[model samples]
Target: MAEAYLLEEVSNFTTKYYADNLPSVHNPPPRYNVAENESSLSLFQGQLGSASGATSKFLAYEEWRTIMLYVLTNLKETMSYIEEFIHQFWRRSRDPTSNEIDTLLKQGAGSGKPDFISWFKKKIDLTEVFGMEVDNEDARDEVDDAKDLQILERLHLDSDDDIPPPSDNLHDYVDMHDIDDETHEPAIIDDDDYF
Candidate 1:
Protein backbone atom coordinates (compact mmCIF):
# COMPACT_ATOMS: atom_id res chain seq x y z
CA MET A 1 0.00 0.00 0.00
CA ALA A 2 2.83 2.40 0.87
CA GLU A 3 4.61 1.55 -2.40
CA ALA A 4 1.43 2.32 -4.38
CA TYR A 5 0.99 5.60 -2.51
CA LEU A 6 4.58 6.61 -3.22
CA LEU A 7 4.19 5.91 -6.95
CA GLU A 8 0.90 7.88 -7.08
CA GLU A 9 2.48 10.86 -5.31
CA VAL A 10 5.42 10.92 -7.72
CA SER A 11 3.12 10.68 -10.77
CA ASN A 12 0.91 13.52 -9.49
CA PHE A 13 3.96 15.68 -8.79
CA THR A 14 5.35 15.24 -12.32
CA THR A 15 1.94 15.94 -13.89
CA LYS A 16 1.25 19.04 -11.79
CA TYR A 17 4.69 20.50 -12.55
CA TYR A 18 4.28 20.36 -16.35
CA ALA A 19 0.66 21.55 -16.16
CA ASP A 20 1.66 24.62 -14.11
CA ASN A 21 4.76 25.72 -16.08
CA LEU A 22 4.28 24.79 -19.75
CA PRO A 23 1.52 26.60 -21.63
CA SER A 24 -1.10 24.54 -23.45
CA VAL A 25 -1.89 24.75 -27.21
CA HIS A 26 -5.20 26.44 -26.39
CA ASN A 27 -3.50 29.13 -24.29
CA PRO A 28 -0.01 29.86 -25.63
CA PRO A 29 1.97 33.02 -24.91
CA PRO A 30 2.19 36.00 -27.31
CA ARG A 31 5.44 35.09 -29.04
CA TYR A 32 5.68 31.36 -28.35
CA ASN A 33 3.54 28.43 -29.49
CA VAL A 34 3.25 25.10 -27.67
CA ALA A 35 5.60 23.17 -29.88
CA GLU A 36 4.00 21.01 -32.60
CA ASN A 37 7.06 18.78 -33.08
CA GLU A 38 5.90 15.31 -32.05
CA SER A 39 9.39 13.97 -32.78
CA SER A 40 10.81 16.15 -30.01
CA LEU A 41 10.90 13.98 -26.87
CA SER A 42 11.96 16.79 -24.53
CA LEU A 43 9.42 18.20 -22.07
CA PHE A 44 7.88 21.68 -22.37
CA GLN A 45 8.97 22.29 -25.97
CA GLY A 46 7.88 25.75 -27.21
CA GLN A 47 8.49 27.17 -30.67
CA LEU A 48 9.01 30.87 -31.34
CA GLY A 49 8.18 31.24 -35.03
CA SER A 50 10.22 33.86 -36.87
CA ALA A 51 8.61 36.49 -39.14
CA SER A 52 9.97 34.47 -42.05
CA GLY A 53 7.94 31.43 -40.90
CA ALA A 54 11.13 29.53 -40.08
CA THR A 55 11.13 27.55 -36.81
CA SER A 56 14.38 26.97 -34.93
CA LYS A 57 14.76 23.54 -33.29
CA PHE A 58 17.64 24.84 -31.20
CA LEU A 59 15.33 27.40 -29.56
CA ALA A 60 12.82 24.72 -28.59
CA TYR A 61 15.57 22.51 -27.19
CA GLU A 62 16.96 25.42 -25.21
CA GLU A 63 13.57 26.36 -23.75
CA TRP A 64 12.82 22.72 -22.93
CA ARG A 65 16.19 22.36 -21.21
CA THR A 66 15.47 25.33 -18.93
CA ILE A 67 11.98 24.03 -18.13
CA MET A 68 13.34 20.52 -17.51
CA LEU A 69 16.00 21.85 -15.15
CA TYR A 70 13.30 23.61 -13.15
CA VAL A 71 11.29 20.37 -13.05
CA LEU A 72 14.36 18.38 -12.01
CA THR A 73 14.99 20.91 -9.21
CA ASN A 74 11.42 20.46 -8.01
CA LEU A 75 11.70 16.65 -8.28
CA LYS A 76 14.92 16.70 -6.25
CA GLU A 77 13.09 18.47 -3.44
CA THR A 78 10.17 16.04 -3.56
CA MET A 79 12.48 13.01 -3.60
CA SER A 80 14.48 14.40 -0.69
CA TYR A 81 11.28 14.86 1.34
CA ILE A 82 10.11 11.34 0.49
CA GLU A 83 13.52 9.87 1.29
CA GLU A 84 13.57 11.66 4.66
CA PHE A 85 10.11 10.34 5.44
CA ILE A 86 11.14 6.79 4.49
CA HIS A 87 14.23 7.08 6.67
CA GLN A 88 12.14 8.29 9.60
CA PHE A 89 9.65 5.47 9.16
CA TRP A 90 12.41 2.87 8.89
CA ARG A 91 14.16 4.28 11.96
CA ARG A 92 11.00 4.36 14.00
CA SER A 93 10.12 0.79 13.00
CA ARG A 94 13.57 -0.42 14.06
CA ASP A 95 13.89 1.68 17.23
CA PRO A 96 14.33 -0.48 20.34
CA THR A 97 11.60 1.44 22.21
CA SER A 98 9.12 0.59 19.47
CA ASN A 99 9.48 -3.17 20.26
CA GLU A 100 7.95 -3.99 16.89
CA ILE A 101 9.99 -7.15 16.54
CA ASP A 102 9.14 -8.12 20.10
CA THR A 103 5.42 -7.68 19.45
CA LEU A 104 5.65 -9.73 16.25
CA LEU A 105 7.57 -12.46 17.99
CA LYS A 106 5.10 -12.41 20.89
CA GLN A 107 2.29 -13.08 18.39
CA GLY A 108 4.31 -16.04 17.04
CA ALA A 109 4.44 -14.42 13.63
CA GLY A 110 7.53 -16.32 12.41
CA SER A 111 6.89 -19.70 10.87
CA GLY A 112 10.13 -21.12 9.46
CA LYS A 113 11.97 -17.75 10.06
CA PRO A 114 12.80 -17.80 13.77
CA ASP A 115 14.86 -14.59 14.10
CA PHE A 116 13.70 -10.96 13.75
CA ILE A 117 15.95 -10.32 10.75
CA SER A 118 14.63 -13.37 8.90
CA TRP A 119 11.03 -12.56 9.80
CA PHE A 120 11.37 -8.94 8.71
CA LYS A 121 12.89 -10.07 5.44
CA LYS A 122 9.67 -11.95 4.68
CA LYS A 123 7.55 -8.90 5.57
CA ILE A 124 9.10 -6.46 3.09
CA ASP A 125 10.39 -7.07 -0.45
CA LEU A 126 11.90 -4.08 -2.24
CA THR A 127 12.58 -5.99 -5.44
CA GLU A 128 9.21 -5.43 -7.12
CA VAL A 129 6.00 -3.44 -6.74
CA PHE A 130 2.85 -3.80 -8.87
CA GLY A 131 4.66 -6.38 -11.06
CA MET A 132 7.43 -3.93 -11.99
CA GLU A 133 10.94 -4.36 -10.62
CA VAL A 134 12.07 -1.36 -8.59
CA ASP A 135 15.80 -0.77 -8.75
CA ASN A 136 17.33 2.01 -6.67
CA GLU A 137 20.68 1.52 -8.45
CA ASP A 138 19.01 2.85 -11.64
CA ALA A 139 19.77 6.30 -10.18
CA ARG A 140 23.33 5.94 -11.54
CA ASP A 141 22.07 6.45 -15.12
CA GLU A 142 19.87 9.39 -14.06
CA VAL A 143 22.84 11.04 -12.32
CA ASP A 144 24.91 10.65 -15.48
CA ASP A 145 22.10 12.12 -17.59
CA ALA A 146 21.63 15.02 -15.15
CA LYS A 147 25.36 15.76 -15.32
CA ASP A 148 25.01 15.95 -19.10
CA LEU A 149 22.46 18.75 -18.60
CA GLN A 150 24.64 21.76 -17.70
CA ILE A 151 22.22 24.23 -16.15
CA LEU A 152 24.74 27.12 -16.13
CA GLU A 153 25.22 26.92 -19.92
CA ARG A 154 21.47 26.88 -20.65
CA LEU A 155 20.40 29.34 -17.92
CA HIS A 156 19.64 32.29 -20.23
CA LEU A 157 17.89 32.48 -23.60
CA ASP A 158 19.56 34.08 -26.63
CA SER A 159 16.51 36.17 -27.54
CA ASP A 160 15.77 39.79 -26.55
CA ASP A 161 13.31 38.64 -23.90
CA ASP A 162 14.40 39.20 -20.30
CA ILE A 163 15.32 36.03 -18.47
CA PRO A 164 14.77 35.93 -14.74
CA PRO A 165 17.92 35.36 -12.73
CA PRO A 166 18.03 31.94 -11.09
CA SER A 167 17.36 32.01 -7.37
CA ASP A 168 20.40 32.84 -5.24
CA ASN A 169 19.24 30.23 -2.74
CA LEU A 170 19.16 27.54 -5.47
CA HIS A 171 22.52 26.36 -4.15
CA ASP A 172 20.87 25.60 -0.83
CA TYR A 173 18.39 23.27 -2.50
CA VAL A 174 20.48 22.01 -5.44
CA ASP A 175 23.93 20.52 -5.02
CA MET A 176 25.94 21.48 -8.11
CA HIS A 177 28.63 19.10 -6.85
CA ASP A 178 26.54 16.01 -7.70
CA ILE A 179 28.64 15.65 -10.82
CA ASP A 180 32.44 15.90 -10.64
CA ASP A 181 33.26 19.36 -9.18
CA GLU A 182 36.52 19.76 -11.11
CA THR A 183 35.05 19.23 -14.59
CA HIS A 184 32.77 21.99 -15.91
CA GLU A 185 32.64 20.90 -19.56
CA PRO A 186 30.01 18.63 -21.08
CA ALA A 187 30.97 15.27 -22.53
CA ILE A 188 32.14 15.43 -26.13
CA ILE A 189 30.31 13.28 -28.67
CA ASP A 190 31.71 11.89 -31.91
CA ASP A 191 29.81 12.77 -35.11
CA ASP A 192 28.82 9.13 -35.58
CA ASP A 193 28.03 8.48 -31.91
CA TYR A 194 24.46 8.57 -30.65
CA PHE A 195 22.91 8.15 -27.23
Candidate 2:
Protein backbone atom coordinates (compact mmCIF):
# COMPACT_ATOMS: atom_id res chain seq x y z
CA MET A 1 0.00 0.00 0.00
CA ALA A 2 1.20 3.48 0.93
CA GLU A 3 4.13 2.04 2.90
CA ALA A 4 5.26 -0.10 -0.02
CA TYR A 5 5.02 2.89 -2.32
CA LEU A 6 7.08 4.99 0.09
CA LEU A 7 9.78 2.31 0.29
CA GLU A 8 9.89 2.00 -3.52
CA GLU A 9 10.29 5.75 -3.68
CA VAL A 10 13.11 5.62 -1.14
CA SER A 11 14.82 2.80 -3.04
CA ASN A 12 14.53 4.75 -6.29
CA PHE A 13 15.78 7.94 -4.63
CA THR A 14 18.68 6.12 -2.98
CA THR A 15 19.61 4.38 -6.22
CA LYS A 16 19.34 7.44 -8.47
CA TYR A 17 20.47 10.31 -6.22
CA TYR A 18 22.10 9.00 -3.04
CA ALA A 19 23.48 5.77 -4.49
CA ASP A 20 24.43 3.08 -1.92
CA ASN A 21 26.30 5.37 0.48
CA LEU A 22 23.92 4.61 3.33
CA PRO A 23 25.33 5.50 6.73
CA SER A 24 26.29 2.65 9.07
CA VAL A 25 23.59 3.85 11.47
CA HIS A 26 20.82 3.06 8.95
CA ASN A 27 20.72 -0.60 9.91
CA PRO A 28 18.40 -1.07 12.86
CA PRO A 29 19.17 -3.84 15.33
CA PRO A 30 17.51 -7.18 14.78
CA ARG A 31 14.20 -7.60 16.51
CA TYR A 32 11.13 -9.86 16.09
CA ASN A 33 11.31 -9.22 12.35
CA VAL A 34 14.60 -11.19 12.28
CA ALA A 35 12.68 -14.45 12.45
CA GLU A 36 10.40 -13.41 9.61
CA ASN A 37 13.42 -12.55 7.39
CA GLU A 38 11.63 -9.42 6.13
CA SER A 39 13.18 -7.45 3.32
CA SER A 40 14.70 -3.98 3.77
CA LEU A 41 11.67 -2.38 2.00
CA SER A 42 9.45 -3.35 4.94
CA LEU A 43 12.10 -2.36 7.47
CA PHE A 44 12.55 1.11 5.98
CA GLN A 45 8.82 1.85 5.99
CA GLY A 46 8.35 0.52 9.53
CA GLN A 47 11.29 2.53 10.84
CA LEU A 48 10.37 5.72 8.97
CA GLY A 49 6.69 5.58 9.85
CA SER A 50 7.32 4.92 13.52
CA ALA A 51 9.95 7.65 13.69
CA SER A 52 8.06 10.32 11.74
CA GLY A 53 4.40 9.36 11.35
CA ALA A 54 3.29 12.98 11.03
CA THR A 55 5.57 13.73 8.08
CA SER A 56 3.92 13.58 4.65
CA LYS A 57 7.10 12.89 2.71
CA PHE A 58 10.68 11.85 3.11
CA LEU A 59 13.30 14.58 2.91
CA ALA A 60 14.53 15.85 -0.42
CA TYR A 61 18.22 15.47 -1.25
CA GLU A 62 19.02 19.04 -0.21
CA GLU A 63 17.02 18.62 2.99
CA TRP A 64 18.74 15.31 3.76
CA ARG A 65 22.15 16.87 3.05
CA THR A 66 21.31 19.72 5.45
CA ILE A 67 20.07 17.25 8.06
CA MET A 68 23.18 15.10 7.72
CA LEU A 69 25.36 18.19 8.16
CA TYR A 70 23.39 19.19 11.23
CA VAL A 71 23.70 15.71 12.70
CA LEU A 72 27.44 15.49 12.05
CA THR A 73 28.13 19.08 13.15
CA ASN A 74 26.29 18.67 16.46
CA LEU A 75 28.30 15.63 17.41
CA LYS A 76 29.07 16.42 21.03
CA GLU A 77 26.98 13.62 22.54
CA THR A 78 27.39 11.58 19.37
CA MET A 79 31.01 10.87 20.31
CA SER A 80 29.94 9.48 23.65
CA TYR A 81 27.26 7.38 21.98
CA ILE A 82 29.76 5.89 19.55
CA GLU A 83 32.25 5.29 22.35
CA GLU A 84 29.61 3.52 24.40
CA PHE A 85 28.66 1.34 21.47
CA ILE A 86 32.27 0.48 20.75
CA HIS A 87 32.93 -0.29 24.39
CA GLN A 88 29.85 -2.47 24.63
CA PHE A 89 30.31 -4.26 21.33
CA TRP A 90 34.03 -4.84 21.60
CA ARG A 91 33.84 -5.63 25.30
CA ARG A 92 36.42 -3.19 26.66
CA SER A 93 39.30 -5.33 25.43
CA ARG A 94 39.70 -3.21 22.32
CA ASP A 95 37.73 -0.04 23.10
CA PRO A 96 39.62 3.19 22.71
CA THR A 97 39.55 6.16 25.06
CA SER A 98 37.26 9.10 24.31
CA ASN A 99 40.20 11.16 23.08
CA GLU A 100 41.21 8.33 20.71
CA ILE A 101 37.66 8.09 19.41
CA ASP A 102 37.60 11.86 18.88
CA THR A 103 40.85 11.60 16.93
CA LEU A 104 39.36 8.82 14.76
CA LEU A 105 36.23 10.88 14.13
CA LYS A 106 38.29 13.88 13.07
CA GLN A 107 40.45 11.68 10.82
CA GLY A 108 37.31 10.16 9.35
CA ALA A 109 36.01 13.66 8.66
CA GLY A 110 39.22 14.57 6.83
CA SER A 111 39.96 11.30 4.98
CA GLY A 112 38.08 9.22 2.40
CA LYS A 113 36.13 6.01 3.17
CA PRO A 114 39.14 3.67 3.20
CA ASP A 115 41.21 6.02 5.35
CA PHE A 116 38.32 6.13 7.75
CA ILE A 117 38.28 2.34 7.85
CA SER A 118 42.06 2.31 8.34
CA TRP A 119 41.77 4.74 11.22
CA PHE A 120 39.17 2.52 12.86
CA LYS A 121 41.26 -0.58 12.40
CA LYS A 122 44.36 1.18 13.69
CA LYS A 123 42.61 2.45 16.81
CA ILE A 124 40.57 -0.60 17.71
CA ASP A 125 40.23 -4.33 16.95
CA LEU A 126 37.34 -3.64 14.60
CA THR A 127 38.65 -5.91 11.85
CA GLU A 128 38.69 -8.86 14.18
CA VAL A 129 35.39 -8.18 15.94
CA PHE A 130 33.25 -6.87 13.12
CA GLY A 131 35.00 -8.84 10.36
CA MET A 132 35.40 -5.48 8.63
CA GLU A 133 38.21 -5.51 6.09
CA VAL A 134 40.13 -2.32 5.48
CA ASP A 135 41.36 -1.70 1.94
CA ASN A 136 45.20 -1.61 2.09
CA GLU A 137 46.24 1.15 -0.35
CA ASP A 138 45.87 4.11 1.98
CA ALA A 139 47.40 2.21 4.89
CA ARG A 140 50.42 1.34 2.75
CA ASP A 141 50.71 4.97 1.62
CA GLU A 142 50.56 6.11 5.24
CA VAL A 143 53.32 3.67 6.21
CA ASP A 144 55.44 4.80 3.26
CA ASP A 145 54.99 8.43 4.26
CA ALA A 146 56.03 7.57 7.82
CA LYS A 147 59.14 5.78 6.54
CA ASP A 148 60.00 8.71 4.21
CA LEU A 149 59.62 11.15 7.11
CA GLN A 150 61.87 8.98 9.22
CA ILE A 151 64.54 8.99 6.50
CA LEU A 152 64.22 12.76 6.16
CA GLU A 153 64.60 13.14 9.92
CA ARG A 154 67.77 10.99 9.80
CA LEU A 155 69.14 13.06 6.94
CA HIS A 156 68.71 16.18 9.06
CA LEU A 157 71.13 14.70 11.65
CA ASP A 158 74.15 15.26 9.36
CA SER A 159 73.77 19.04 9.29
CA ASP A 160 77.20 19.65 7.71
CA ASP A 161 76.35 17.63 4.62
CA ASP A 162 72.69 18.72 4.44
CA ILE A 163 73.48 22.45 4.76
CA PRO A 164 73.74 24.46 1.53
CA PRO A 165 75.90 27.58 0.94
CA PRO A 166 74.31 30.92 1.82
CA SER A 167 72.11 32.28 -0.96
CA ASP A 168 69.60 35.12 -1.52
CA ASN A 169 66.79 32.71 -0.57
CA LEU A 170 66.29 28.92 -0.36
CA HIS A 171 63.85 29.13 -3.32
CA ASP A 172 66.84 30.27 -5.45
CA TYR A 173 67.78 26.57 -5.71
CA VAL A 174 65.29 26.43 -8.63
CA ASP A 175 66.79 27.01 -12.12
CA MET A 176 66.15 30.74 -12.62
CA HIS A 177 67.58 30.78 -16.13
CA ASP A 178 64.37 29.35 -17.66
CA ILE A 179 61.99 31.81 -15.92
CA ASP A 180 61.55 35.38 -17.24
CA ASP A 181 60.43 37.65 -14.39
CA GLU A 182 58.77 40.06 -16.87
CA THR A 183 56.59 37.28 -18.36
CA HIS A 184 54.89 36.54 -15.00
CA GLU A 185 53.00 39.86 -14.73
CA PRO A 186 49.23 39.88 -14.15
CA ALA A 187 47.12 40.28 -17.31
CA ILE A 188 45.72 43.79 -18.08
CA ILE A 189 41.93 43.71 -18.45
CA ASP A 190 39.81 46.43 -20.14
CA ASP A 191 37.24 48.32 -17.99
CA ASP A 192 34.46 47.40 -20.47
CA ASP A 193 34.54 43.73 -19.28
CA TYR A 194 33.49 44.75 -15.74
CA PHE A 195 30.05 45.95 -16.84
Candidate 3:
Protein backbone atom coordinates (compact mmCIF):
# COMPACT_ATOMS: atom_id res chain seq x y z
CA MET A 1 0.00 0.00 0.00
CA ALA A 2 2.76 2.43 0.92
CA GLU A 3 4.67 1.59 -2.24
CA ALA A 4 1.59 2.20 -4.35
CA TYR A 5 0.94 5.52 -2.61
CA LEU A 6 4.53 6.62 -3.12
CA LEU A 7 4.43 5.61 -6.78
CA GLU A 8 1.18 7.51 -7.31
CA GLU A 9 2.51 10.62 -5.60
CA VAL A 10 5.72 10.59 -7.64
CA SER A 11 3.84 9.99 -10.86
CA ASN A 12 1.39 12.83 -10.18
CA PHE A 13 4.19 15.22 -9.26
CA THR A 14 6.19 14.38 -12.40
CA THR A 15 3.14 14.67 -14.64
CA LYS A 16 2.15 18.01 -13.14
CA TYR A 17 5.68 19.41 -13.43
CA TYR A 18 6.06 18.28 -17.05
CA ALA A 19 2.66 19.66 -18.01
CA ASP A 20 3.41 23.04 -16.48
CA ASN A 21 6.96 23.43 -17.85
CA LEU A 22 7.24 21.54 -21.13
CA PRO A 23 5.44 21.62 -24.45
CA SER A 24 1.92 20.18 -24.48
CA VAL A 25 2.64 17.47 -27.04
CA HIS A 26 4.29 14.41 -25.53
CA ASN A 27 5.80 13.33 -28.89
CA PRO A 28 7.23 16.08 -30.99
CA PRO A 29 8.34 15.42 -34.59
CA PRO A 30 11.42 13.16 -34.85
CA ARG A 31 13.40 16.20 -35.98
CA TYR A 32 12.48 18.04 -32.80
CA ASN A 33 13.00 15.06 -30.50
CA VAL A 34 16.51 13.63 -30.07
CA ALA A 35 15.30 10.64 -28.07
CA GLU A 36 13.46 9.34 -31.11
CA ASN A 37 16.66 8.83 -33.10
CA GLU A 38 19.18 8.12 -30.33
CA SER A 39 20.02 4.41 -30.08
CA SER A 40 21.63 4.70 -26.66
CA LEU A 41 19.70 3.05 -23.81
CA SER A 42 19.44 4.68 -20.39
CA LEU A 43 18.68 3.15 -17.01
CA PHE A 44 15.49 5.19 -16.99
CA GLN A 45 14.59 4.37 -20.59
CA GLY A 46 11.47 2.54 -19.51
CA GLN A 47 10.16 5.54 -17.59
CA LEU A 48 11.35 8.18 -20.08
CA GLY A 49 10.38 6.08 -23.12
CA SER A 50 12.70 4.29 -25.54
CA ALA A 51 13.95 6.13 -28.63
CA SER A 52 11.59 4.37 -31.09
CA GLY A 53 9.00 6.87 -32.20
CA ALA A 54 8.48 8.63 -35.52
CA THR A 55 8.21 12.41 -35.45
CA SER A 56 9.85 15.55 -36.87
CA LYS A 57 13.44 15.55 -35.59
CA PHE A 58 14.61 19.12 -36.04
CA LEU A 59 14.90 20.82 -32.65
CA ALA A 60 17.25 23.74 -32.03
CA TYR A 61 20.32 22.98 -29.94
CA GLU A 62 19.29 25.43 -27.22
CA GLU A 63 15.77 24.01 -26.98
CA TRP A 64 17.08 20.45 -26.85
CA ARG A 65 19.57 21.44 -24.17
CA THR A 66 16.81 23.09 -22.11
CA ILE A 67 14.63 19.99 -22.39
CA MET A 68 17.51 17.72 -21.38
CA LEU A 69 18.21 19.99 -18.42
CA TYR A 70 14.59 19.88 -17.30
CA VAL A 71 14.50 16.07 -17.61
CA LEU A 72 17.80 15.63 -15.74
CA THR A 73 16.75 18.01 -12.93
CA ASN A 74 13.45 16.19 -12.51
CA LEU A 75 15.21 12.81 -12.56
CA LYS A 76 17.70 13.93 -9.88
CA GLU A 77 14.96 15.21 -7.60
CA THR A 78 12.86 12.07 -8.07
CA MET A 79 15.84 9.83 -7.35
CA SER A 80 16.56 11.78 -4.16
CA TYR A 81 13.01 11.21 -2.96
CA ILE A 82 13.22 7.51 -3.77
CA GLU A 83 16.54 7.22 -1.94
CA GLU A 84 15.11 8.93 1.13
CA PHE A 85 12.07 6.68 1.05
CA ILE A 86 14.19 3.54 0.87
CA HIS A 87 16.40 4.73 3.74
CA GLN A 88 13.43 5.60 5.91
CA PHE A 89 11.72 2.31 5.16
CA TRP A 90 14.85 0.35 6.01
CA ARG A 91 15.44 2.31 9.18
CA ARG A 92 11.91 1.98 10.46
CA SER A 93 11.42 -1.67 9.51
CA ARG A 94 14.81 -2.91 10.69
CA ASP A 95 16.11 -0.81 13.59
CA PRO A 96 14.80 2.57 14.63
CA THR A 97 17.55 3.34 17.16
CA SER A 98 20.47 1.13 16.16
CA ASN A 99 23.20 1.05 13.50
CA GLU A 100 21.88 -2.22 12.09
CA ILE A 101 20.34 -0.45 9.10
CA ASP A 102 23.67 1.15 8.24
CA THR A 103 25.41 -2.22 8.52
CA LEU A 104 22.83 -3.82 6.26
CA LEU A 105 23.17 -0.98 3.70
CA LYS A 106 26.95 -1.39 3.74
CA GLN A 107 26.56 -5.12 3.27
CA GLY A 108 24.26 -4.51 0.31
CA ALA A 109 26.98 -2.34 -1.28
CA GLY A 110 28.83 -5.43 -2.55
CA SER A 111 25.83 -7.66 -3.25
CA GLY A 112 26.24 -7.26 -7.07
CA LYS A 113 22.54 -6.57 -7.30
CA PRO A 114 21.54 -2.93 -7.68
CA ASP A 115 23.86 -1.31 -5.12
CA PHE A 116 21.25 0.52 -3.09
CA ILE A 117 23.84 1.86 -0.68
CA SER A 118 26.01 3.36 -3.38
CA TRP A 119 23.04 4.77 -5.28
CA PHE A 120 21.73 6.34 -2.09
CA LYS A 121 25.10 7.81 -1.13
CA LYS A 122 26.29 8.85 -4.58
CA LYS A 123 25.50 12.38 -5.77
CA ILE A 124 24.41 12.86 -9.37
CA ASP A 125 26.65 15.10 -11.48
CA LEU A 126 24.76 16.89 -14.26
CA THR A 127 28.02 17.89 -15.95
CA GLU A 128 29.03 14.27 -16.39
CA VAL A 129 25.57 13.33 -17.58
CA PHE A 130 25.02 16.12 -20.12
CA GLY A 131 28.19 18.25 -20.30
CA MET A 132 26.32 21.08 -18.56
CA GLU A 133 27.75 22.12 -15.22
CA VAL A 134 25.34 22.81 -12.39
CA ASP A 135 26.09 25.30 -9.63
CA ASN A 136 27.51 23.79 -6.45
CA GLU A 137 26.53 24.90 -2.95
CA ASP A 138 29.28 27.55 -2.77
CA ALA A 139 28.47 28.96 -6.20
CA ARG A 140 24.76 29.04 -5.37
CA ASP A 141 25.48 30.83 -2.09
CA GLU A 142 27.66 33.39 -3.86
CA VAL A 143 24.98 34.05 -6.48
CA ASP A 144 22.35 34.43 -3.73
CA ASP A 145 24.58 36.84 -1.79
CA ALA A 146 25.23 38.91 -4.94
CA LYS A 147 21.50 39.14 -5.61
CA ASP A 148 20.81 40.19 -2.01
CA LEU A 149 23.53 42.84 -2.23
CA GLN A 150 22.05 44.19 -5.44
CA ILE A 151 18.60 44.46 -3.82
CA LEU A 152 20.05 46.24 -0.79
CA GLU A 153 22.00 48.65 -2.97
CA ARG A 154 18.91 49.43 -5.05
CA LEU A 155 16.98 50.24 -1.85
CA HIS A 156 19.86 52.42 -0.51
CA LEU A 157 20.19 50.27 2.59
CA ASP A 158 23.40 49.35 4.38
CA SER A 159 23.84 45.64 5.12
CA ASP A 160 25.74 46.36 8.34
CA ASP A 161 23.03 48.66 9.75
CA ASP A 162 20.95 47.10 12.51
CA ILE A 163 17.21 47.62 12.74
CA PRO A 164 16.19 49.97 15.57
CA PRO A 165 14.73 48.19 18.58
CA PRO A 166 11.02 48.68 19.16
CA SER A 167 10.16 51.25 21.87
CA ASP A 168 9.43 49.50 25.18
CA ASN A 169 7.94 52.49 27.01
CA LEU A 170 4.38 52.97 25.79
CA HIS A 171 3.75 55.77 28.31
CA ASP A 172 6.27 57.95 26.40
CA TYR A 173 3.99 57.89 23.35
CA VAL A 174 0.56 58.02 25.12
CA ASP A 175 -0.38 60.31 28.02
CA MET A 176 -2.52 58.08 30.23
CA HIS A 177 -3.21 60.91 32.69
CA ASP A 178 -5.01 62.95 29.98
CA ILE A 179 -7.61 60.21 29.49
CA ASP A 180 -11.06 60.90 31.08
CA ASP A 181 -11.81 58.87 34.18
CA GLU A 182 -15.54 59.59 34.02
CA THR A 183 -17.80 56.57 33.45
CA HIS A 184 -20.85 57.77 31.59
CA GLU A 185 -24.10 55.83 31.97
CA PRO A 186 -25.60 54.41 28.82
CA ALA A 187 -28.28 56.70 27.34
CA ILE A 188 -31.77 55.23 26.75
CA ILE A 189 -32.46 56.33 23.17
CA ASP A 190 -36.02 56.89 21.98
CA ASP A 191 -37.14 55.85 18.45
CA ASP A 192 -36.54 59.46 17.36
CA ASP A 193 -32.80 58.86 17.43
CA TYR A 194 -33.19 56.39 14.54
CA PHE A 195 -34.67 59.12 12.31
lDDT of each: 0.39, 0.42, 0.41
At residue 140, candidate 3 shows an lDDT of: 29
Better of 1 and 2 by TM-score: 2
In order of appearance, the predictions have TM-scores of 0.16, 0.19, 0.17
Indicate the residue-level lDDT of 111 in model 3. Answer: 24
Cα misplacement distance, residue 26 of candidate 2 (Å): 32
Encode model 2's per-residue lDDT on 1-195: one tens digit a residue: 999999877875565444233322344344432223344432223432233337578889658645553464365634543554344333245657767655544433332322232333333442453366432333234323333334334433222222223333323334444444787433455699898
Question: How many angstroms is residue 92 displaced in model 3 relative to the true structure, after the best TM-score fit?
Answer: 35
Output the number of the TM-score-best candidate. Answer: 2
In model 1, where is the ten-residue run with the lowest total lDDT? 113-122
Ordered list by TM-score, greatest first: 2, 3, 1
> For each candidate, C-alpha RMSD in Å?
25.6, 17.5, 24.2
